[model samples]
Target chain A: MALRGRDIVSIRDLSTEEITEILDHARSMIPVAEGKKSSSALEGKVVATAFFEPSTRTRLSFEAAVQRLGGRCLTIADIGVTSMRKGESLYDTVRMLSSYSDAIVLRHPNEGAARLAADASDRPVINAGDGSNQHPTQALLDLMAMHETFGTLAGLKVVLLGDLKYGRTVHSLAIALAQFGSELVLSAPRALALPEDLRGELESLGAKISDEPELRRAVRDADVLYVTRIQKERFPDEGEYRSVAGSYRVDASVLDGAKPQLIVLHPLPRAGEVDPEVDRTPHAAYFRQAFLAVPVRMALLSSILAPTRGG
Target chain B: MVRELRITPIRNGTVIDHIANGLALDVLRIIGVRDLDKDSTVSIALHVRSGKIGWKDIVKVENMELSPRKVNAIALISPSATISIIRDHQVREKRAVDLPEHVTGVVRCPNINCISNQGEPIESDFRVVRRRPVVLRCAYCDRQVTDFLRHLA
Candidate 1:
């Protein structure tokens, strides 16, 4: 049952019970994450943030989590300035970092790079994001946000809106939610819908996923409405991207018919997918979701680095 | 009078029999045609009628025995296939090819973005998700792979 020295490369790596344990640990860290209380759970520990890819929230939140838990952070915020620019392999770099750090938080442009890093490092490795492959912590925090709002993870109707095809967060979160017995509804444009293979996998996992073409319609009975931007960079054809760019915007107006208990979430740095006006609504939990990153990451850091102390 | 097509058996080598019909060539591809010693004789029987299975294919190679990995690759393509080792023109050992729980380096992941395809210093690892259809999931990135032929490593 111990997660000490374990890697969080993908949500699939953690079972439902382990995910719940992490979420429960995150709940207890909220006060400390907010600086209202303090503890030295990660005292004398060093967590490294190695980012070969550009990221804002994930890297910052992980660093912030380490510091809040009374641990120091070694950050490689840019690859262009590091030995990676000299063609150093991820294996060599992580192996060197593991010598100085107790845990490593890695974000890389290559998919599955974290797993390779984990193999190279003796210390625990956490995948911040790996090129459309996985961001397990984001899925964990998303789960934490949902649990905090609803007090449960099972049997909730969740509508996944926007770019399901290229949105890594939605893909990982969808799989995690399915494992927890959540009923999923997909609300995305035809071209940007969830891949058939992933849909088949979810269906095989006994998850009931329904397709609703309209976001407004899909949110009618959903307990959670998770939205993602249609990434323009992922589209090879600019014209095709333009056609679906504004297809599914979630404004306050769209929430008119949604259930009062329905909460809206987005993995942010959004580009017109969620309206600014929607941020003021009570249903807007994306900010809370973003803020939950600290405590959730703190929980993860403690689980991997301080498991013996039950921090 | 109708006559059965016959090819001479080798004195010592291996016989891969009961491959699903029309898959004998794939078995050869898995075993690598160029890898076989040019001096040894190899025979392929395609779409051969069989009593146990309606139609089957068999491949016999002289002075060549398949490794467990190659045999596993053959199993992925043809689950019902059996491998027989011959010594002194006698069948020494015969057993069905068994697909191991973890398949390594046999096939490349179809995911272009998969780390296994990124020239990393590790062979591709797959978990056997389904045996009947032979579904493989990449151990690194969690991508499922079902199409095995074109992506053979």
Candidate 2:
């Protein structure tokens, strides 16, 4: 029941019970975050945000979460602007940051950067986002959103649209969703489809997964349309991103044939993927979803940094 | 008498048999054994035609206990390899090589960008997620490694 000082690098490390516990805690913190109630569970703790890559939502959410818990935040927003630009290795950077904080939240461009940082640091390291590998906190917030919206995650028809291969959020979400017995519809371009082995593993977990190139047919009867941007940054060639960028846009027109109660979710910073017009509709939960990050992350941070009952 | 292709018997050492043809060198590389010492005798036979399974390679190492870790490396490189552990000129243990839970300090990640490949004093750790399909997921990066690369280490 105690998760204090734990490094949250991946959802794979969390058991179903622990995940549910975190969700329960997140639910409790939601009212506090919306200014209906207040609790300073993480009162004297300090969180360090060490972002080696560019991030606005993830970084700020962690800061807001820490402040909401009556804790302070130390941020190194740009690695290029820090001592790292002067040739400090990631290990040294983490070692230095660990000395100043209780927990370190890392967003790095390398796949295993967070793990490496955790190994080097004295404090717990939370992976905010790691290069197309994992974003565990994002997965947590996503599950929290689903639970809040539908009241249950079991047996939901979720369709993940756009760039499965390069989308870190979807990758982590898919792994988390597998535990809930959710059927998945993956719609992406052939070049951007989920990896063959990930698909096989999900199938083994009894997730009814089907890949479709066309977005329209895939989202026709979906309960949740989880949209992700086609990350141009991950493409090896700029021309490849250019070729596939416009294929899976979810505009206002695209949702005409969608399920009546379809909740459209996007882990945003959108680039022409979800049209601006769709933001006014009832289906648009993306902004509210983004705002939910604060409470969910606060719950996560509090649980991770709180004192142990046995001790 | 079937005209036997002669192999000098190792006096008191392990013999790894049933290695897929052309993978003996790869197995050797994974085990970090490029050249055998003068005191430690090693014999390798490659591309030997086998009646049961087309062609195979065999490696014999004298005065050494073939660790399960080494056997795992052999499994990664050559899935069909059978390990025979010899003690006092007798086969003590013999079995088909199976993947290990965590293969540390052996069989480096094939990904060029992997931290293990960068000579960072980090051991390459792989968890055997699936045995039948022979998939090893890297502990650090979560990269699925199917093929063993010689140049990685």
Candidate 3:
């Protein structure tokens, strides 16, 4: 299937083969992502980075991806200075932006905001992050990092720890990993466990899921330890947020019993959920996971912008 | 063998038969009871015995025909409903209302965070996940919406 003129709003929108193809293209883009080589795949094209919400890594990652592909960027890093503050709807903003750019990268504070923008824009739309709903590219990049380390997504034991309920990155990543037939062991506080509906949906997709209450016990036999931060903004009450804050911490002691090849991944902007001392260990792949965003996003942008470029 | 009619037959309107048990009022709301003509006569029979189904409700109106949109709305609350258009005391058209594959603009998404409920210009679009006991999921937010009556648009 042709990916040209398509929107990347949810990881669920991609199939196993399409995801594999994207990852394969990402492998070839590593040199470009590292600035060791450059490509004009998106030359003479303008990609708009519309961040209605605050984001440091994803916005910079998309800008880096676009620039590395030899494309210029039209950025709106702040919503306060835009027409949105003057009572403009997201639809109108996306419609106007679609007229000026070849493709759009949208990040909004509302759930399903990217889905709404995709319908309004004529050009392809990439969901950078939409509230606590979905961040497809982040999941894709996470998959890229895992595939690079392990050489395959199938049959891997992945332990998802921390805030599963409100972490958008985990939601998409868990679903994508399940699609690749990975065994998932969920470890989190009872209050912050993954939603039951999502668990059922993942099971229906043929995922083998088990629950482990202890983080240390869950990590003992895991291949990948994906940690997430407890989000204070997602809780309805301050007391509820306070109760679960600092519930699980991954330190060097946690990995003492684990296999040497076990890799720890985190979608950064950490709030001390993973200890800084753990970064010195060989198990720290979160930084590499962060850097993989460029190649994965570059693969997506090139596939959408230049489909006939022999990806 | 013939059974007596529960309500007087209309000469030039519509007779909706085989509505699910105790759903006449919900059907009324779905068709917008307030939007009906004041001059038209409306009759409803609740919990009437039926040979096909155990018990069903029936509704008859005089001098008013329901639009296709209203007929589709009835399918959500009462899947077994059959509409018979009467013209000069004869059944002009008779057909069972069908639950459309895709429901649009009729029922609002119940999720507060859904894009359709964010005061945007986009209409609420849902894919019918199941029939019999109808289930609809929002196209934008992927939230399953089951109670259709309370969230009617």
Candidate 4:
């Protein structure tokens, strides 16, 4: 259960026990993260964030996790201002960073860049997000949110809505939930629905997934409703993006017929997908979900840097 | 008038039979026919009619035996092919080539952005996750590549 020197490249790499272990540790970290209890677990350890892509939430959360645990962060100022702009490859930058850091958290534009960086570096490389491939920690925090609402992850009717194809968070979350034997309902318009390759992969992993475009079909009798913003950049045609964006937006009124316990979660930076009206409703778990990142990530940082776990 | 067909048998070698028509050359390239033993001889028959298949090709190599990898690599080009190991002018062992669980250094990833395709000194590896309508999953990027022949390294 001690994830000492392991590379966190994909959520698929973790066993169910390991994921549960993480969630259990996250539960313990809540008091410490809230400053009710103090811990100096990671006093001297150093973490480096190599974000090649622009990020706000994931980046800041990791820095907060490390700092709150009394560890220093060697965050890369900007890749554009660094040697990367001078034509340095990800491998070279990662190897150089490994010399100065205990662990490297990498976010790159290429799908397998974290894998390449892990192979090159001498330290554990946690993938923040590599292109549209996966974001493991995001999935972990998301599972934490689900656990907070449902009390457990198994057998819950889970509905994933909007931009399933390009949304990395949804992709990782769906795969993680499949292990718990959840009946997945994929609700998105045809143009923005989950890709067939991923759907087949999920099916192979033993997840029952159905295409339910209408929110009503998915909301009824569902325990969890996961909504995501549909990126306009993903659409090649401006008109096509316009037509699908408004149809997927969920407001407070949309939840009128939904189950009272139906928890609506979004991996944020919403762009007209979830209406502002929904934010005040009991269904909105995203804001609380964002705050939960602190405790969950403190668990990751502490457990990863603990001396008991071997590389 | 009736015509008598004459064929020469090799003492030791492999006979790759029932290759699809117009792919004999591709099969040769896939198996690295150019790297054959100096003393070995290769005989090829292309665009020939067969009872089992509409149009077929056959290749015979003298003084050489093909490995399972080579056989699998050849199967990518010609799935219907049968590889027969000949010994002392007799077919000792024969079987149809089935796609291997993994194919490495045989076909390059079609994605140019993939690590295997980039100039990284990495061998191209693919997992044959599907058969019938052959699908090769790239080991690096997990991209499904269908056009197997076009990306041969």
Q: Give the Cα lDDT of each candidate.
A: 0.89, 0.83, 0.90, 0.83
Model 1 misplacement above 4 A: A236-240, A307-311, B1-5
Q: Interface root mean square deviation of every model, in Å?
A: 1.4, 2.1, 1.2, 2.2
| lDDT assessment of candidate 4 | 0.83
Q: Which structure is stronger by TM-score: 3 or 4?
A: 3
lDDT of 1 by residue, A105-217 (tens): 99887777898898989998999988777888999999998999999989999999988988888888999999999999998999998988789889988999999987778
Which residue pairs in candidate 4 have backbone atoms (N, alpha carbon, C) closer than 3 angstroms, thus clashing? none
Q: Give the backbone clash total of model 4.
A: 0
DockQ of 2: 0.38
Give lDDT tens digits, candidate 3, residues B1-153. Answer: 897866787789888999998999888877776777788888999999898889999988888789877897899888899999999999999999998988888888877767788888888888898896898877787677788889988
Worst 10 residues of 2 chain A by lDDT: A84-93
For residues A1-311, could you state the per-residue lDDT of candidate 3 as single tens digits?
Answer: 46877899999989989999999999999999999998998998899999987788999999999999999999999999999889899999999999999999998877789999999999999999887788899999999889999999999999999999888999999999999999999999999989776788899999999999887889999999999989887787899999999888999999999989999999988999899999999999999999999999999999898855465
Top model number, DockQ: 3
DockQ-superior candidate, 2 or 3: 3
Could you tell me the lDDT of residue A282 within candidate 2?
Answer: 86
Candidate 4 lDDT over A44-136, as tens digits, reads 999998887787888888888888888999988478788978777677888899999999988876666777777888888888987667788
Docking class of 3: medium
- Of the pair 2 and 4, which is ahead by TM-score? 2
**What's the best-to-worst order under lDDT?**
3, 1, 4, 2
Error of 1 at B94 (Å): 1.3
Query: What is the DockQ ranking, best to worst?
Result: 3, 1, 2, 4
Regions of model 4 farther than 4 Å from truth: A233-247, A309-311, B1-22, B29-43, B47-56, B60-72, B75-102, B110-121, B130-134
